[model samples]
Target: MATAPEDGMKHPRTTNERLIDATLDAWQFGGGATISVRSLCASTNIQVSSLYHHFGSLEQLLVSAQEHAIDAAEAWCTRQIGLLADDAMPPAALGALLAGLIDDWCHDERRLAFAWRECHLNAVKQATFIPLAGRWTKLWSGFWAELCERLGIAGHAITTARFFAGESGFHLVPWNRQIDRAALGETCTGWSAWLCGQVSPPSPWRDRARALAGAGLVLPPLRDDVAERIAATAGAIVERSGVAGLTYRAVAVDAGLTLGVVSHKFRTGADLLAAAFDALYRRAATRTADELADLPAMQPEAVSHELAEMVVGEFAGSLGLDELLLACARNPALRPFGGHLRYLRGRTSGHYLAALLGPAKPTHHIDAAIFSSFLIGVTGVYCFVQDREERIAGAEAEIARVIAALTGG
Candidate 1:
């Protein structure tokens, strides 16, 4: 059993018993974002008003959920760290600890996927989770710092903790296929061991993770060959259906996973789509290394050409683009969408400004915004042109025209 600090915290098993039990069952067993209220209601078969007595709204209920998770996580960490006592951090024990958390408690490839997605898309949920996240970060960092000290790695705890967190996720996802729980454990163990051998993961958490796994509290974390599955799922959605088709239920069913599993990772369909987009963008960004490197000295025409390609190749397949645009058009309130516009500007406006201005510095951001707008306009057109050559030629022509106007070229 895990230990909690002497903070008179509610046991997630009792106290606010219904909320805690519901949360634990959901988070650990593949629960959905709306599951907090829905599950509680279903389990108790209570009236909405009665439930509101305890939680004011769905958002409040989620806060309750986050609070429960925070307590559980703190207790979990406390127990693992206590086991280390005065002993030097143990590598194998650390692996088990991480594997257990990732594969079991955090639902590793399960709940974490949900946690990551919600943190991005759900503002209400995001705010609700902040405190829990702080607890998590602090505990993990402390454990890592202790580990680093034992293994002779010198660094500020914050830096080392962030480094470990970044690396820890490398093999956890199923980029190729959706890593399974068992494989996740192995990967966690392998990663912890590897990190321990090299510079070492910030210490107590690492060994404690492994220790927890060994003690049957968590499953071993390892890598799975699921990259292909993840890729295929993403490719199918992009090539055939685009963003609208990337729903949680659809993805879960297609991937032969529980809907809860998908929801746990991604609270809403939008989150799932955004993540898929980001992953694809990152992959394409890697291929644009030379283009990025040469941006500083490239001719205006070359820069324009690169921006055109990104608009067509990277964004053309977003099925939701039209719907998104239409929503903004129909819903007057959405017209002043600062965030959306800012994001578009980041991607395209700077590129356009830079291409039109010259090879000098500071043109990119301005041009990227302009180009991003042009890209949005093209999205609005809903061009169904099937001829690749014609499309390519037209894009080039449009780029030339835009450049001429933008730069007096």
Candidate 2:
């Protein structure tokens, strides 16, 4: 169980501190995404009166816990950046630094990252969380901007910030096999240096990473179209309230079908969720196809602008896509379907890159994945943060610049 940090010698924890610590512990390890007063009290051995007295309510306590988490993350990042600046590391070191940061977040401190994202999803679903989410988006964006400036890569700061955010989400998916951490680190280092205007040597593992690509998002055909309708209904619920909201009764009621029939078709909540994942991916795949068809005729600048718009629009307009992808990762039965999204995310971006970089220039799957992930990060930040329109415009400009850099245009 997590507890409040000790300054020197350990002092006895106050009731408020104990409550907050319990919440953080549950968030990090105990699968406590949705905590209640009862659960917190039960775990901490504190009475309900104490919780109400210190935090007023469970909602306030959760908020306080999130605030503490974000603050800790910020402090850690600041320390890392300070060390980098003090060492006067060259631009080439940026990638290694980035790799190190992400490595820590994904490995040693993975539970914190997981909890952070879970909280973010909740923030998106509930209006009450908007303030915290927006503040977090801003603080992190500023941190990225500062790091870029310090590293002499100020020009690509916004785009890099957005890309890192997306990469954070992309790496969150629990893959069947262990991730190639060294290859991933080297690839990121080379790319980071290249982006910062260095002539980076091609990573040996580039092809191997690219080989992880999937055959794009292809769903198995349903025996009857009604199953598709049922999936769509379940997907809509996921969009509104996440996977927890997806139930047979809810889907049946929403789709105007009988519970017996819905249950008969899907059999289990996991089955329905799997079907919904297919449905959501199908929708995204259709959009990717439709968007790619026009890229051939569009100018490179127009293609860059459109790519940014499309990615942001897709994520901002619907919450189900991210939720379903995460759900697929968590559920064993849905892992196979989830794996495709891991590699194929860049299909649309790859096409857009092809239009910009031309048929001759190699637009690798890995590049597409990076670009698409950045777009995802951009969308994630833009959706919750303040100055929405301004940020979008700035992000589009940075996206174009990144496209130019990555494609050697």
Candidate 3:
């Protein structure tokens, strides 16, 4: 007979619990989309049979991992809310609460990992995980709605919650890079306080704009080369600091150009973002084509592996593609540009299929769409892993799996 662990559950229950815990831990670290059952088993010291017996399928296991993480986050938030003893939380209490949330989000590795995974899953629109994702959104929104009501903060509660959720991922970026945590926390607290209407101040950027306008500093028109440099600078900003950080002033500072020059060239923030994404996509396409050209002619039986290698190489070398895609996915101003990039990628995939298969079937077009989506999901997952070699190996394996499925290999 199988022996039970010290926790007192029966052997099977213990095994299932271990598998669930291991799956959550691995999924949080490896990202929910890229983690395979084999990896999970290796990490957990459990067998594939045990995983199947518990979760039935990889998709179910991922769903379970998401459910487990969401439940844990909700429980933590509920406990934090319990700290507010009265019906109405005062400004001080709200500030403290927001600060505590920021601390948890920044200092806790598990929370940070899961938050990034949730953002990626949401961006990719993975249908299997939508219900769980919706639950998380509802939980946070409900908490914010109640807090806003108590604090008499008159605004769209759900929108405010969603905005904070988006900002949470943004917050994690600096945390991941071991940037100044103290400064990040302070900024988060200040932003939260301002959002709750607890603080009101004149816009610093507006004041700067006025200062610039009052100076009567007429700038020359942007030359073509300077305009391209500005666009490339914007791409780097989006890659490094995310879409929220891509301000005209920031671009101007980075490009060594005056703010007037950047503004004159791009006109609006949307125009600037479009230009940035255009540069990013063109660079990615060019890099991918270059790498694919280096690969030998594909054999039908080995084409999947060749394509997988090409994808891994492209992603490994491309500096901004991952961040650019995620930032564009979340920014409404960038959606049309993102859509155009997706169409281009799908067309590119179809071209590769035609090259390899001699003729593209109707199914090839659909496969190309699926292939594009798979690349997005895998790339998102790849960004969160801490180990570079492990990330590259996982990318190759995952891409191979995707290609095999698409090509019926």
- Report the candidate with higher lDDT, 1 versus 3: 3
Q: Which sequence of candidate numbers ranks them by TM-score, best first?
A: 2, 3, 1
Report the C-alpha displacement of residue 39, candidate 3, in angstroms: 0.9
Q: Give per-residue CA lDDT, model 3, range 301-344, as digits (tens).
A: 36544444445444532445555544444444444444343333
Which regions of candidate 2 are displaced past 4 Å? 1-9, 25-33, 82-85, 126-128, 193-220, 267-270, 285-290, 314-318, 328-338, 385-392, 407-409
- Candidate 3: worst 10 consecutive residues by lDDT? 174-183
Off by over 4 Å in 1: 1-15, 27-33, 36-39, 89-128, 154-156, 163-289, 292-409
Could you give me the TM-score of model 1 versus the true structure?
0.41
Give lDDT for model 2.
Answer: 0.68
Per-model C-alpha RMSD:
18.1, 4.3, 20.0
Selected candidate, larger TM-score, 1 vs 3: 3
Query: What Cα-based lDDT does every candidate model obtain?
Result: 0.44, 0.68, 0.54
Tens digits of per-residue lDDT for model 2, 1-409: 5675666666788988888888877655433334679989999999999899888988889888888778877877777777664544466667777777776776666655655766677776667777777767777778878887777777767677766777766555555344546545654764685484433356555444445534423454556878889988887887776666788999999999999999888876667876877677666654556667877888877776666656554453246787766655455555555566665567766687678766666655666667667767766665654465565676677677775666555
Best by lDDT: 2
Give me the candidate number with maximum TM-score: 2
Location of the lowest summed lDDT over 10 successive residues in candidate 2: 209-218
Tell me how many clashing residue pairs each candidate has.
57, 2, 0
